[model samples]
Target: MEIAVCRAADVALLDECIGSPGAVSSHARRFARQGEGGGTYLVAWIDGRPVGHAEVIWDGCAAPEVRAALPGCPELNGLGVWPPELRSRGIGGALIRRAEELAREYGRTVLGLGVAADNPRAADLYARLGYRRLTDYVDRWSYEDRDGVIRECVDPCTFLTKELPSGSLDVKRT
Candidate 1:
């Protein structure tokens, strides 16, 4: 299995893996905006097929309250491993480690992320990966559904954080 930053050519494969063309485009746009105020999108591949995805946002883009609480922390967002059968195969963990590596590259010491409050399994996974719950947060956002109708989402989430090991901070813009 190979885990790396998503490139232009991997977009369609990501869409197929996640079963959502819209999501693939959304992540691609985020990646395009990297260094211009966005983040890195990573894809995990097995046998040349995409199996998981995640993004590391330099800006937390959280609510003002949450932002104030987590000053200087970049967020690991939009993490997913697809096709039910692919769960527990370490793809998700590898994607997360890639995000941490990118965070370290940006000279960041603390990495933050929000997990859905109702998702205990994911929360457990994050905990095992060294992320400790910092605070409760709510994410309010809107997006277009498959039918092209805009829908609002208000997710009750828990903010978690982990400290990266100190190293030669290499600020690579990829």
Candidate 2:
């Protein structure tokens, strides 16, 4: 298995993993628009097949309240491991660790992520990984569906944060 940052050449493989060509194109565009201090996508591959992904957003997009509570923390968003059978294989954890590495590369000392209030399983996993709830937040965003129709979403979530140890970029994955 290989975990690495996604590049332009990985679009088709990402599309295959995500099962949405439009979404892949959108991600590709976002990756291209990223500047020197911007964010990028990370993908996990097994046997040359993409299986998981996450986004390391340098410009944290947390709500104002959450942002004020934990300033200067980059966000790890859109983390997913494809197909039900792939769960518990550590792909998600690996992707998250990669996000932390990317955050460290950006000179950030903290990382943040939002979990749906109802998702205890994910919240538990985050807690076990040392993330603590900072505050409640609402995630407002929009995206185009596979049919090119735009949809808006507002999720009630809990903002969680983890302080990264300085100079710990070389921390090994468990």
Best by lDDT: 1
TM-score of each: 0.88, 0.88
Task: Give residue 52's error in model 2 in angstroms.
Answer: 0.5
Off by over 4 Å in 2: 20-26, 33-37
For model 1, where is the 10-residue window of minimal lDDT? Answer: 19-28
Clashing pairs in 2: none
lDDT of 2: 0.79
The positional error of residue 122 in candidate 1, measured at the CA in angstroms, is 0.6
**Which pairs of residues collide in model 1?**
none
Candidate 1 differs from the real structure by a C-alpha RMSD in angstroms, to one decimal, of 3.5
For residues 27-83, could you state the per-residue lDDT of candidate 2 as single tens digits? 565566453547778888888888887887777865897879877778888888888
